[model samples]
Structures are given as structure tokens and as C-alpha cells.
Target: MSPPTRRSPRSRPSPEAAEPNGTFDAATRQQIDAVVAALHELYPDADCELAWETPLDLLIATILSAQSTDARVNQVTRDLFSRYRTASDYADADVAELEEEIRSTGFYRQKAKNLIGAGEILRDRFAGEVPRTIDELTEVPGAARKTANVVLGTAYGIPSGFVVDTHVKRLAHRLGLSAETRPEKIESDLMARIPRDEWIFAAHALIWHGRRVCHARRPQCGDCGLADHCPRNGL
Candidate 1:
């Protein structure tokens, strides 16, 4: 898809568009539509950056991604996946050995514990299969709403909710798409404004945009195609 035409500076939202009161009025919703459209144009193929071939791989990678980058998680999983091929493999893994394998991802002890617990849950509850629904997925030790959303949308094509990672959270605030502080609240705001069909794509696009352009610090507003639609909140 071609990028959206850059809006003239004069057409940009006024300072009042920041909407400090946090209301999703007509104008705010319209701006959201524009932002979503621009995101589509900018990242038509955006997807979960984590490398995974199976639902179980994605689930484990998402857990490892907590407090770590996708690149790092992928590096660890390359060797880890080869050794632990199934839920039972992880369930039977030695905690110390697993921790050493994923040590580079940080918080290795807890992450290893969570992974083992997740494996046990998957093996016992789901018959060695990853759960499809959010509730069941989240029941796994490390799969929260964000992780579950990633697994559901990316693996099963289920639009359960928006994946509110740090990048999505930052971009949502900067683009004036959500004024909420908490991840769940931010996700709720985005889900309300963004169409269900576009939920998965929108989250991926926002994450890509956040990483590529709209950084948490030193956001490249000048090069942003959505700058006109964005209110430049907290810039």
C-alpha cells in the first residue's frame, strides 16, 4: 500500500486536539482513523517480530520477550527451541539448566520458572497443545493479556485485543490515540477506537512505527507521515 499523502501543516490538529480530558469524541476518533490509515500505508506487512514457527514457540518467545528485545529472545530461542521441542520437554527441564540457557534474556530465574510452569500447564491442561482462547492462554504462567494477544492474533488469527507493548503504549500516547497510563487501559482505549478487523494489524503497525520512527526518546516527528494527525502529546 502506498503511504498516505502528507497533510499540509495548516491541516494539522490544533493544540486543543490533545484532549487532556481523555474523551474519545468525534474529532479524536477521526484523527484515530487517519493515524490507522497512515500506519497501514507505512507498514503493510508488519507482524510479530519474534521468530516462531509454532504456537508454542510464539508463547515461549513472548514470555522471554518480557524485559528483553525480540532480537535477544530470538537468539536465546534458537538453541532453546532445538533442545526443548514440546511442552513436555520444558515441563521436564532442569530449572538451573533452563535458566542458564536463557540467562542472556535477563530475569532468567523467573522466566525459567514461568516457562516451566507454562509447559506443565500446556502439557497437563491442553494435552501438550497451546490453548487457543485468551483465558486459557493467560492461564499459562507467563502469558498475560499482551502475550496472549500476540499468540492469538499472530498464531491463530484471532483478534482478541490490542497488543500493548512499550512501543505501542508510547506511540498511542504520542499520536493522541489514548491518554491512559496503564497498558490495559491504553489497550481498551485503542480497541474502542480501532476496528476489530484491524486490531492485529494496527498493533503490529504501531509497534513497527514506534521502533522505526516514533521512538520513546527523540521521536522523529519531522519524518513521521502521521505527524499531521498526531497531536504530539508529551513530546
Candidate 2:
């Protein structure tokens, strides 16, 4: 036993690495409520920024938004949507042409492939309509839990689960609302803490706050509305 093998600094668990137990006491619940109130006040009009007129439009836009900004996705979809109005249109699209259409979205090849696959599934399995349930939506290509949640909540007004995007993930940790690293686990913590009715609104509000104030690289803590309640965890 060579002097009790010392653990390296890098190997040590981060201060922010505590895992949420998916349950909260009264005090914690109150804090969560306060945070929700703050968010409501901060972003009263918080909603999905992606431009879409139909469930299929939203489903495609959300899928296109992966690793891309909403603004960019919106721009691309403006033209793409006009060209491909239905699932059958996408299912029949040429992969190379589709790739070129969404080339600026980054990972165009894969995105195009997923879009085609999703379109085919929606056309064949779902009768050319976006599925309402998370399980069904996740069956489409490019629609993982996050994307499925977005489609379900925003498109169908069903709070299947919280949409744990990068912004939500960052805000969850910084606000000390969750201590989990994985999005699914973090979503579980959030669902446990936030009210069922407020699930959809909370996800949108957190996203807006994260984009406007709690930025990833340089959070404007001074301008943050939740500054008082925020423990500034892992800052």
C-alpha cells in the first residue's frame, strides 16, 4: 500500500456533481415555486421561438434545431417549409437536394437523412401527421426525448416531460434546481420540483432566461432576476 494512493485533482468529484434524488421537501418546493414566479415575471411571453404553422412544421423545425440556433433554423425552414408542406414531400425528397437546402444548419447530411426517415415514418405509421405522444414521436428519426418533448408540449400542448436543452441544462445547475449531468435525469429532478401545470411554461421560461441572462460563457448574474434565490452553483 504505497502511502494510500492519492486521488488526483482531476479525478475528484466536482462540487456540482451531487445527484438529485428526484424528491424535494417543503423548503425546496418553496424555493422552486419562488424560482418559477421569478421566471414568469421575467419572461411573461416566453414561448417556442421556432416558426411553424402546423404540427409537422414544428416537428421538422425542432428536429432541424439540433446543434443549431433557432434563428438559423427559422431562416432555413421558411424556404424549406414552402417547398415541402407535407410528410410525403419530405419522404420523397432527394437526399442531396435536401442536404443543400439545409446545408447551413450544420450536419446537413445527417439532418437530411433523419428528416427523410422521419417523414417516411410519419407518412406511413402516423398517417402523415405528427404523433402526439412522446413514445410515438421518439420513434421518428432525429426526435429524441428533448425533441419529442418539444413536439408534445409546444405542438400538442401536452407536457409529456420537460424539454432539457443546453440552456435548460445550464440553468438547472446554475440555479441549483438540479445537480444531475444527464438531461433525462435533470428532467426527472425538474418534473419532481415543478408543478404539473407549469411544466411547459417553465421549460420555455428557463430557456428564455438562460438565453437572455444566464449565458453559458458569461452569465449576466447582476441582471438576473433569480439572482437572489440562485446559489450560483458551480460558478
Candidate 3:
């Protein structure tokens, strides 16, 4: 009889990795709390990185942020916003020129089209003012919770909820506070776990952590303050 199929030694770790031995112990809970406290104190002034001068600017900047870095969006919008001030300006903008202006942000064609379309909607439907409510904002072209959140929070001083992007999703998963990978699911998990008062800042802290320490790839676990508490599972 043929010898039993030999399994590679490396495969032995798979079971160990998935096993939930001590997923959330008391110590882990304490550490999670402490980590959040540290971040709150460390980044009290945590704000959205996108630069904008007005509510409309913020709306435009956020619209330009899809699949793009905040820094890049800011860079592009610096000049873009000056040239196009109001909804009418964007709505009537020459598509090719608008595309060229935001080319650096990636997906410029789609972004420009969305911007123009959203601008037209704002002009026709809402009198050119960025809406303060979630449902109204989402009705615009290319506006989702992430974009609407920026407008509601930064533009209207309303807590629309957390802005969960790639950074937040990865960081939340690595931090063991959430098992879900999708941004919406992760946002829901975070909202359920965190205090409503901290919703705005929690996203900022997570973003800062994701960018600085808990990166999507090769997170610096050794230096991370929450490393001890981190499950680092499925990461």
C-alpha cells in the first residue's frame, strides 16, 4: 500500500492560527481600552487630512478621494477648487479639462463625470448647497457614506458616523475589534463597540494608526502599543 500522504510540516500552523484560544480575555479588553485612550490623548486634534476651504470644497475634495490617497486628492484639488468654485461651475465644466485637472488622483475620468453630475444634481435639486442629511447627500452621483460622512461632519458639524476606508477596515481587523473585512461591516462593528461620542475621532485614530503603525502590509507589531493586545489573527 502506498504510504499515507505526508503533510508538510508548514501546514501544521494553519489549525493553530484559526483556533480561538484566547480571543478576547480580560487583559485584552483592558489593553484595547488603554490603546484607545492613548490614541485619544495622542491625537486629540485628529482631523480629516483632506484640505478644503468650504463645505462645497470639502464635498468636492471627498468626491475626488475615491480609490485615491488624501494627499493626492488635496494636491489635485488645491488648483481644481480655485478654478471651480460653485456647483454651477462644476456642472458646466468642460469634461476634458476637468479630467485633466484631476488626472493625478487616478480614475480622473469617472471622478470628473461624477463631480459634474453631482454638481448638476446639487444645483437642480438642492439649490447648490451640500446637503446636511445622509439620505439627501447619498442621492448625488458618486456620493456614498464615506463621502457623505465627510460633508456631514466637517461641513455641517454633524456626526454622520465614522468614515471607514481601507485603512480603517485593515486596522480594525488587525486590532481584533472586528472580524469583518468590508468597510460597511467594519464600520458597523466599530459603531457597536465604541461609544457614539467617539465615532468621529475613532475613525481618525484608526486612520492615523493604519498609516503610521498598523499598516495593511508589514505592520510594525513589535513597536505597536497595542501589539500585546492584538490577536494579529487572519492578518
Candidate 4:
């Protein structure tokens, strides 16, 4: 009889690589809450890193932040904000010039167009003031649920929903808080687990955690305070 074929150890999956699409049960909820509490303790004063004084500023900055860093967006907005003080200013801005100003952020053409269109909507539809509600804000160009959440929660002190940026998405999966891939679904799962009052704070804390410890390429699991609680998904 032929000897049984042996399987290579490389064929076996590692613990982190064998992560399940986690479920949100009662016990899962408790774990999630504990994770949130731990994150809050770790990052007690987490807040939006974007630099903005007004709702419109935050709205524009969030849009620019799509494929760029907050620091880069702030650098561009430093002069951009001063130049365009109101919706009318952006609405009247020369597209080519605006694109040139923000060219370093990448996808400058689309961003400029979105900014101009957003300004027009704010000027024509909302009377030159950034809308307060999520529905209204999402109607503007480049202001999706994530962007609207940032604007409403950070600028207006209204916790419309959690801001699911790349950081939030990554952390949510790693922490086993949500298994869903889409931001909207992940957000729904989070909303169910996290209290409405902590929605904004939770988002900020998760973002900070992702940036500082749970990095995309190599999460600092050794130093992470939440390592014990984290599933270390996709590690």
C-alpha cells in the first residue's frame, strides 16, 4: 500500500488568517462594549484630526480626505479656506485654478468639481449655509454618509452616524466589532453595539487606534493595549 500523502505545514492556515466573519450576539455585544471602553481609556481625548473652524470647512476637508491624509488636506485647506470664505466664493471659483490649487491631493479635477458643485448646492439650495442634517448634507456633492457624519458630528456636535473611514473599517474588522465589508453595513453593526451618545467618540477613538497601533500592513499587536481583546483578524 502506498504511504499516505503528507500535507505540507504551509497548507495549514494561521490563527489570524482563519478569522471568521464575526456575528453580533449578546456575548459579542459585551465584547464589543468592553473593546470600546478599553479604546476610550487608551485614547481618552480622541477627536477629528482635520483642521476646520466651520461646517463648510469640515465638509470640504472631508471630501478632500477621500484618498489623501488629513495632514495633506489641512495643508491645502490652509490657504484654500482663507480664499474661499463662503459657498459663493467656491461656486464662483475658476475650476482650472481650483484644480491647480489642490492638485497635490490627487484627483484634483473630480475634487474641484465636487467642491464647486457642493458650493453651488449650498448657495442655491441651502442659502449659503452648510446643512445640519445627514440627509441634507449627503445631497451635496462629495458628502456621503461618512463625510456627512464627520461634518455633523465634529462641526455641529450632532452624532448622525459613525464615520467609517479606512481606519474605522480596518479596526472594526480586526476588533471583531463588525464582520460586514461595506461601510454602511459595518456602521449599522456598530450602531447596534455602541451607544448613540458615544457614536462620535467611538469613531474618533477607533480611528486614532487604527492610525497609531492597528496599521494596515503591520499592526503593532505587541504594544497595542487592546491586543488581548482584538481578534487580530487578517493579522
TM-score for each model: 0.88, 0.89, 0.83, 0.87
Residue 147 displacement in candidate 3 (angstroms): 1.3
Model 4 TM: 0.87
State the lDDT of candidate 2 residue by residue for 106-189, as single tens digits.
999999999999999999999999988776888899988888888788878897778899999999998887899988788877
lDDT for residue 188 in candidate 3, whole number 0-100: 63
Name the Cα RMSD for model 4. Answer: 14.8
Which parts of model 4 are misplaced by more than 4 Å?
1-26
Error of 3 at 214 (Å): 1.1
Model 4, 167: alpha-carbon shift in Å? 1.2
Q: Considering TM-score, which of the candidate structures 3 and 4 is the better prediction for this target?
A: 4
lDDT of each: 0.82, 0.83, 0.75, 0.81
Against the true structure, candidate 2 reaches a TM-score of 0.89
Q: List model 4 lDDT by residue over 185-218, tens digit each.
A: 8887777677777888889999999899899999
Off by over 4 Å in 1: 1-26
Writing each residue's lDDT as its tens digit, candidate 1 over 27-143 gives: 866787788888888887888888777788888999999999998988888878778889999999999999999999999999999999999999999999998887788788988
Model 1, backbone clash pairs (residues 3+ apart or across chains), number: 0
Which whole-number lDDT from 0 to 100 does residue 103 have in model 2? 97
Better of 1 and 3 by lDDT: 1
- Which candidate comes out best when scored by lDDT? 2
Model 2: runs farther than 4 Å from truth? 1-23
Cα deviation of 64, candidate 2, in Å: 0.7
Query: Candidate 1, after superposition: displacement of residue 219 in Å?
Result: 0.5
Clashing residue pairs in candidate 1, if any?
Answer: none
